[model samples]
Target chain A: MAFNILIVDDSKTIRSVIKKTLEIAEIPVGELYEAENGQAGLAVLQENWIDIVFADINMPVMTGIEMIEKMNADNLLEKTPVIIVSTEGSQTRVEELIKKGVRAFIRKPISPETLRNVVNEVMGDYDEGGN
Target chain B: MKEETKDIVYKVCCDVFEHLAFMFGEVLDEDDITSVADTFIKASMSFKGEQQSGIVAIVVPEELSVNLAYEILGLEKSEQIDPDGPEDAVKEVLNTICGRLLPAIFGDSPIFDLTPPETTVISYQEWEELVQGHAYISLEIENNPVLITTSL
Candidate 1:
């Protein structure tokens, strides 16, 4: 089953790079969506059926943490996986995010291999067409 | 800044450029600093940690900025690029560099709050003024001068 993914970042270049990386990694994507910040990401989430979300930490209007908080407040959205794709590298911050329902954290300059591995690890058995 | 700190910033700058844009950079000798181009782009961002707070900035020639954008986007030489591509690319580069540099300097335990990166286009004369006032780490990437500075 192809997964519907949402990418949230302030930089258009980064959003494009992540999309390119997902394509290069050959990850099966059902419907890929883009948002410039966390507020917009939440709007997309509310409007679409997203399997997973890739978000950056620092953004204008709202932050990734804030978006996650909003997601956690909802019953259905809380179950959806969120993997952080950011330049942030603090272990403390990582732990904090994990505690806040973040599935995984990926640093910037992400490689195709890393993305593939993270996807497989987070969405296990999905590769075999399992939801 | 101390020489050791400068060394760390320099190393981080080189590594980020190579990893993010597939561009290799070498440490530029101080004496070799010369006006190679009249136009330049400067990207800067601030960070606040528990014990340290400061700003990190990067300056690159306009020509190099375009190259950075193209390489980062994995575009061909003939492909057209958006006008905002170069500016966005440089800002992202600085953002990545700042993120990595903080961890390298202060370890992974200290969480940092980083401001969104800001960019500006400056003339060579303005660049010269900045060079004279700040202690910056210079690098040569694609034979163009790149500068990184930190203000604590």
Candidate 2:
């Protein structure tokens, strides 16, 4: 099944890049939703059949960490897969994200390969490598 | 700028532009940097982390900001600029730079919280206030002037 993914970042350029990168990685995306920040991202979650989320840690209105924390609190979307796609480099921050139930964290300047591998890791046997 | 800070800034600026923006840049001597281009857009953000707390800013020429929006978005070059697109791109590139820069300098054990980058129109005077008194590192992105400053 093709996955429906959501990207949350304040930068339109970054959202566009992530969409482009997903196509380049050959990850079959059923639909792609873009949100400017965590608040908007949470709203997208409510309105779509999103399978995964790729979020930037720093964003206006709401940060990625806050979004994930909210998700964790909501029983409905709590188990949804979340991968942090951010420029955040601090080890301590990474630990905090992991503690909040983030499935993976990928740094900025992310390549097609990194996106593909992380997606595969999250999806388990549903590997894009086979596709 | 301290030699250590300059080195970190230079490396981060180079990496962020080349990889994220698909643009190549090299840090130049402050004397070598010039503000001949008048119209500009500036993006500034603050970072709080284990060892450092400072402001990071990136200023780019007016036209270049629009050009970069397309470049980073993987869109074909166009004559018209999407008003919000250019400013968003400029701000994001700086945010990405700080995000990448922090990990490189502080190691992963420490954490940093970065403010969302803000982009604005500015006169050369405001730009000078930030760039002055430091051996600021400047670059030519696609031959257009770009300045990056970090105050700790």
Candidate 3:
């Protein structure tokens, strides 16, 4: 079964690349939604169901970490795994995100295999026959 | 701040290009590296450690930058690559490399902070006239040339 996914980043290029990567990787996609920043991402979340979110840590409007913080504070961290896809590779930064309930960290220039692995690992039984 | 800073930067370039080439399914050549800053993509990131501030600027070619982005984002050629992206693809490459490399150079678990990457396009004319004698490292990965310039 395909899953609904949301991608959040300020870069249209990055977003387009991700969408294409998912398609190329043959990840099942029911419906794909995109937001340029955290606020828009949250709005999309409220409006539709998203199984996972691939986000960049650094953004103009609202950062990925800030968004996760808000989500956790509001008890909305459940039901979706937000994997941080970014260039920041500091260990401290990674640990901080882990504490906030982030599923995993995939640094920039991410690979197809890594993306697939993370999605599958996080979604687990929900994917219903892994894509 | 020593004369070896150039060597350090060069080593960093070699190490990073080798790793990136392996990751991108290609091995880079030294001949492909170009020092001409005009065709470079300018990227800057700030690092703070021990009350000392370091800024890393990576100047890369547009095509190479796009290719790196493709490798990073895993996109096909059909997808258009934008030179203007917030992720600062090339800059992020420099930032991550430096962030990892600097500590090893410092030989300590120093608290280093990184800022987001910022990038821009640079023309050859401007590069020759303005960026005079700037320190940069050039490399060829699978015959693809990559350049990096830093201001610390």
Candidate 4:
């Protein structure tokens, strides 16, 4: 089964690159939704059934952590895995996110293989038949 | 900062260009980037943390940014890239570099909040004057001149 994914980041360029990376990684994708900031991301979440969320930590209107906090509060959306795709590299911050229920963290300048592996681990394989 | 620390900054700049832009670059010895080029775009970002607070900036040549956008977007030659693609590319690249550089220099414990990148189009004359007294390193990417700077 293919996965419907949402990417939240302020930079259009970064968002585009991520969509391309998933394609390059050959992950089966059902639908791809994008939002510029965390507030917009929450709206997307409410409207669509997203399997996974890839978000950046720093944004103007709302930060990724804030969005995650809201999601954790919502019982309906709490189970959806959130993978932080950010420039944040501090161990302390990363630990905080993990403690708050983030599934994984992938730093900036992310690679295709790394993205694929993390997604597969969190959402299960898209192809289903193969690893 | 020591001379070696500056070298690490240059190395990190090279890594970002190579990894994100899929291009290679070498550091240049120059005080002013404007003296070397006429038209370019600049992107800057700031980071605030307990250990340090500073800014990082990158100036890229117009044509190189176009090539980088095309590479990053993975579009065919026939598909035209966006008009502001170059500026946005520089900004994103700056964002990536700043995120990586902080951890590389200060270890993994410092938690910093980064600001989204802000980009501008400026002439060499403006760039040369704007970067005065800043600690910076210039690089050559695909025979095009680019400059990276840091201020603490």
User: Which of the numbered candidates is closest to the native, going by highest TM-score?
Assistant: 1
The C-alpha lDDT values of all candidates are 0.91, 0.83, 0.68, 0.84
Query: Comparing to the true complex, what docking class would candidate 4 get?
Result: high
lDDT of 4 by residue, A46-102 (tens): 999988899989999999999999999998788778999987879999999999999
What lDDT does model 4 reach?
0.84
Better of 1 and 4 by DockQ: 1
Supply candidate 4's per-residue lDDT for B86.
73
- Per-residue CA lDDT of candidate 4, range B63-117, in tens? 7888888877777779987787778788888888898888888988989988889
Task: Candidate 3: give the clashing pairs.
Answer: A109-B72, B27-B142, B28-B140, B28-B141, B28-B142, B29-B140, B41-B60
Model 2, position B61: C-alpha lDDT score: 83
| Superior by lDDT: candidate 3 or candidate 4 | 4
Candidate no. 4 TM-score: 0.92
Cα error of candidate 1 at position B151, Å: 1.8
Q: Looking at every candidate separately, what fraction of the true A–B Cα contacts under 8 Å does it contain? A: 0.88, 0.96, 0.16, 0.92
- By DockQ, the better pick of 3 and 4 is 4
Ranking by TM-score: 1, 4, 2, 3
Worst 10 residues of 1 chain B by lDDT: B128-137
Which window of ten consecutive residues has the lowest lDDT sum in model 4 chain B? B29-38
The sequence of per-residue lDDT tens digits that candidate 1 reaches over residues A35-77 is 9998999999999999989999999899999999999999868
Return the top candidate by lDDT: 1
TM-scores of the candidates in the order shown: 0.96, 0.90, 0.74, 0.92
